[model samples]
Target: MVFFMNIRHLPSVFFLWLSISLLSLGGCAQWRPTTQDSVKPASTGDACEPGVINLNRVTGLSQIIPELKKARAVVVGESHTYYHHHLAQLEVIKRLAAENPHLAIGLEMFQQPFQPFLDEYIAGDMDETTLLEKTEYFKRWKYDYRLYAPILRYAREHRIPLIALNIDRDITTRAGEVGIGALNDRDKSHIPAHMDRDVPGYEERIHPIFDQHAGSSKRSFEHFMDVQLLWDEGMAERAAEYLNQHPESAMVILAGAGHVAYRTGIPARLQRRIPGKIVTILSSDGIKLEPGVSDYVMFPAEKQLPKAGMMGIFLEQKDQSVAAVGFSDESSGKQAGIKKGDRFDRINGRKIREIADIRLAMWNRKPGDVVDVTVLRKGKPISVKVTLK
Candidate 1:
């Protein structure tokens, strides 16, 4: 199983959940079906068939691409951890890149501030390791790098420009806590220049889900609203800016399903800024979506990455080094002479000074890989070799 730990305050969980129930009832999106089996025009009030799109089985890419190619921007949504969703995203990107001479990929996984490193990586001017470090991938978008490694590798190999399309988490966090009005000027600059605070049907749909959470007071809900808008608007602005600058180029956008569904989030916001067709595609992870949810819903086969290497020990961050605070059941570290309070000095010859450094060292490693770890045990350096599990 892949584990992801966010280092900063995360956006609202409800937004991440995508309010399937609300979307299922009365969401609206502009989508045309290329095949008779794809989608049929139905009443928006038809609750039985949301947006009138067939939601039963997977739709083939051949039937979907004709409509997708007509759009200036195509947004592909993922469930983040579900590896197959990423495969679906990559398939679309590969097809689109092959046809469009000038193609760019916009990623919600990367923050807007790190575009330079992404540019360098795709240009082959920087190595993968340096790109991960410089962009702070392990610290920010903390999903196992292996899940996204294939997409990143392909982008770099093909020299496709990758656009970073997210605001920093700190900015979103502060906005959620104190509202956007309280943010300082520098932080404000990172947000969208103009926000559509009252997006049609967005608040009404999201409010009920917001109320289900523990702290659903009106004021808290306002804060939640602020965070969601900031994420959608901020990312939309970045993508629009890029599209406006290079009007001839087409972009494949990779983002969470919540931001793509119903075209009310990033897709709608981006469309408002740029004059062109924008198509939204969602990969179904057994998610029952309504008709206007996206242009096409792909049913992809299941995919799983190889199990990540694990030391099987809990770590505590010390000032100079990371310490073993505890061990999991049947921990390999404990079996290999590692003890609680032993501070990590190095792993596989890479200096391990922080949690991020440890994650970097283990990024490409798989289960059963053995490595030498140096630890400071009682003022003496001790070397222990352990098999990762």
Candidate 2:
């Protein structure tokens, strides 16, 4: 659940999400994976073209569906903010379902505590707002929900099992702040011992990145590594556990690309615990995707179009209205005088209560368009005009 950053960018990469506080505050940075950070490089391998797949003990590049069916678990990695990547993932799921209908989707976004919410949501017993709020989606995962809608819609339509496969963030944060020594007997119960399996390749890449950034640091790089492994192992263990419980079902595990890239994060850890065929697929995203980095790389063969535009504001359902919690300072929302803590009442004359409503309203809006917004500021309703940048 880490932000995908191209290390080649260096100091400029820090500008994407890194603030002065992030470099200074150790606990805040490691505890939350929301902010941008160094992405580990792929393990040793030669360069391969987009369509080719460097799979486990395989020879040459392979087609998507054929190779997907061959695995007991196919871990597809995603950058939470990348909307198109999730569409690519949905395409994979659609193709895989044709071969095996008894499919399960394991998620890294939702914590283990909210397994019931996922169950209920998948059962079609709850609404989207309830599901998001109950799972603490706003608190834990701040990415746009629209990016995940396709997968969720597919799962619900088919009534496929959705497995929640990560431990609570608080426990993971504790492991990152202090080593595993800080975990009490209760915390130990949440994660199994097998999560400590060797991922030497991951260590190779993450170590240098951590060292490069963590100059004169008080905390050890190994501590950060421990937290990541804790995350990887917990997810892998839970996925294995689900497979063990539902032997007939094969899974398409959705997680951050870092978790499965080069097979160092989850695939290897899961293999150490339970021996079975596992594969990874990730987005090329115009980056130099090294060979053997993943079983398959997904993107347009010719080119990738830039993502669509919108008012750069992070919203959450607040009481009867949607509240703004974050904003892209350079975006139009800032220029239009929309501030944090503003509760939405109307947008372009349509009542707005959820994020989907805003997306629907903005469907026809272009980059330089102005957005008419009404908000409740300081308990008084007010109107604000925002230009979408």
Quick one: best lDDT, which candidate? 1
Tens digits of lDDT, candidate 2, 145-195? 667877988998888888888878988888877877778999988887765
Q: Stretches of candidate 1 above 4 Å error?
A: 1-59, 208-213, 318-320
TM-score of 2: 0.67
TM, every model: 0.84, 0.67
Q: Residue 181's C-alpha lDDT in candidate 1? A: 89
Candidate 2, residue 186: Cα displacement in angstroms equals 1.7
**Per-residue lDDT value at 324 in model 2:** 88
CA RMSD per model (angstroms): 8.3, 11.9
Per residue, candidate 1 scores C-alpha lDDT tens digits across 163-217 of: 9998998899899899998999999988887988777667876787688899679
Clashes of each: 2, 0
In model 1, what is the error at residue 339, expressed in angstroms?
0.8
Q: Give the TM-score of candidate 1.
A: 0.84
- lDDT of candidate model 1 versus the reference: 0.79
